[model samples]
Target chain A: MNIVVIDYGMGNIRSIQSSLLYLGVKSVIVSSDRNDILKADKIILPGVGAFGEAVREIKKRNLEKHLAEAVLKDGKPILGICLGMQLLGLSSEEGGFNKGLNFVNGVVTKLYGEGIKIPHVGFNQIQVNENSRLYNGLNSEPDFYFTHSFKMTSEDDIGASHCVYGSRFVASFENNNVAGVQFHPELSQNNGLRLLKNFIERF
Target chain B: MLRKRIIFTLIHSDGYFMQSRNFRLQKVGNLLWLEKNYKFQHISFSLDELIILDATRNQKNLSQFASIVSGVVNDVFIPVAAGGGIRSLADADLLFKSGADKIVLNSLQYENPLIVRELVEKYGSQSIIASVDYKSTAEGHLVYVNDGSKKIEYSLKEYLTYLEDLGVGEIYLNSIDKDGTGFGYDLETILNVKDLLSIPLIIAGGAGNEKHLLEGLKTDGIAAVATANLFNFIGDGLPNARNHIISLGENIANWNANS
Candidate 1:
């Protein structure tokens, strides 16, 4: 099976690539090429930077249309991380306002004020949701690495892993072949590796 | 059932937030050598204690610092604490605005002396953490701040008593000589500080193994233990650190279950 990691210069591509290799999966880094998206068995859009930058890059490359058609029409599995996860939402309050991939019905909001931290950096616990293939065979309620300032508040809670900082936020969610993680799985330790391996094996 | 209290510290290299790097060393070929020798990723998702410090240690302009704090707290999943170059109530407020769970202040306690009491009045004692970095001096033990940039004349006893009077929540006690050493925590320091205050204290610097963690837990006044080496152990091509720590903790819990 051929796995393609999307490259839009807004992600931790090399680390994600290295992790896949560690999982014994041979994955190719895909660019803005239309043929590449259509050809791969699975596509991974791993991101690290701001939400607005990711949306702009996706639109600029016209890969947004290809991604929508591929996932909705072609039934390809696509996973997003951090900003990539926010991109799966319909919109975000990152800087001003911006549109997202809209694969999931959600909005990204910034964390602020008392009992709430903005970026929410470092390791945090993950409360596993029912029927989650992403957390299959792993111990329940494990710590996952995180680094971001925005979180997705989805309309529906499907394949959700909930964790509370100041308020309850979506840590990870899955709908059909589309899965999103607010934390970086590539940066997570053994549990993160298991998550990546699960995605490679099942997705 | 009691929920596991999670602690998060944001690790910063120089000024920019990074995974882990000691500040005392300078290597011309280190970055390139690191890239070539090992697979280094800047923000790996495996961290329990994340700490961010101003690499420059600039005390004045806190707006820029607050912006950095604002940028990191939204996505992280744990209790986040920040320390370094803080000197006033306004500085503490800026850190709070930026999303810090606890504002760790050291020299500011001595500089104004009344600021801790004022902060306790405004934000409560739990939010204020009096940070101390102590070292063995010719006279005795000296507590200092700014990563030991200046020496404070006050002894650990006097400082802890002063903070308790101010009603601060916890004491973040660090040892400069033991930092980045991995030798183990300064047990004597904990013993000495524990005698001075009834409030919770966190022991940082030189945590090398599970044995060290066990010792820290046994210490009287310690609330938690913090380490940069722990994160480096897992994400740094070693045998995944988080899994190892979790497994170690589980083993101890199980042993206690049988006992």
Candidate 2:
């Protein structure tokens, strides 16, 4: 299966590419071509860095429109990780009112607490909300690593997996072919591999 | 569902495990036994690349780190990477003998770029991870040593090229400005290095959330991104981050199939 990982001057691209290869699916990293985006069976908008910067690169490369069309119109599978996931929302309060990919209806806001710390790091449990193809072979609550301060807040129940940090925040969410998870499966353990394997098997 | 990779980090210290949490101090010896016991029970079940940083390995803690390495050598079978205060071929040798699968060299790369060539030649390119710790200075992001106290007037791109020419296989770019800040990694610095090299680059510092991980991964050539305080008894971080990634991978997998 061909997977195209969108790159826009953010974080490591090789780890995701390697993770895909390890899961037995080869992927291509593309920053500037429409053909590459159109040709791929699946599209992945992997991001790391600031929301504004990520948005700038996506728009700068002109991959944003094509990506939106592919996932929203064509029903092609697309995944956004970490900042990429946050970018799938309407806006984020990280720096300013930065607009996201708008595939899902929500706003990414900062975690509310002082002594609780800013970047919530380390391992925590995940309670699977409703049946998701993503949760295959997974128990109800599995330990997953997390690191983030800003999170997506939404009123729609069908679109998110909630995790309570100070207050419950959206951990994973999906809207039709468009889906986003505010986590890095690439860094998680067996649960991570299993998660990737499930994605590959589905493809 | 989305797919993800695994990265494990270790920090070694002589004094004690001094954390931001209530100024609690755990004796090194006592911590080692607990860590070792945890590894013995949990390691086999997970897929993670181990990263060991000898916080005090410079002069006093060398023997201590070596002993620690020996203790976990057999129990932890995954790839073990060691960093901190590595300056010479001799230091690299000690780490390798102690069963470090990969040796991370940081400040030494600046003192003498040729050391990178020598180490890579002896250990092969993959074994040498040239770590660069820098902070955003008024001048630029300056690489430094002695735990980011000393500053060197070198652009990150310049050092990347220098190390690349030296035949160093990988680079661990740590942003001192972001370290402990948990703001997320300095993607700008990581991208600068990623733009220049073909080698694997790991972005470190200021990873407060999975958002930082995603940002680090989005860089064109980054191989891995790491955070210290995230994995252990820090905030409710590591598990949430890992699980989120796993859920993301699962999301992509299912999305791919049905979509």
lDDT of 1 by residue, A1-203 (tens): 67788877553254566567767776565576888889888888877556666777778889899898888899999888777888888898876799888898878887654533233544567778978988877776766666566678876866788777667788988888999888777655566777877887787
Kindly give the stretch of ten consecutive residues in candidate 2 chain B with the minimal lDDT sum: B250-259
lDDT of 1 by residue, B93-159 (tens): 6676565655778777778768777766555455566777788667778877665778877787787
Sequence-dependent TM-score of model 2: 0.52
TM-score per candidate, chains pooled = 0.56, 0.52
Superpose all Cα atoms of candidate 2 onto the true structure and report the RMSD in Å to 1 decimal: 15.3
Badly placed stretches (over 4 Å) of model 2 are: A27-32, B1-259
Model 1 CA deviation exceeding 4 Å by range: A112-114, B1-259
- The DockQ-based CAPRI class assigned to model 1 is incorrect
Error of 2 at A154 (Å): 1.0
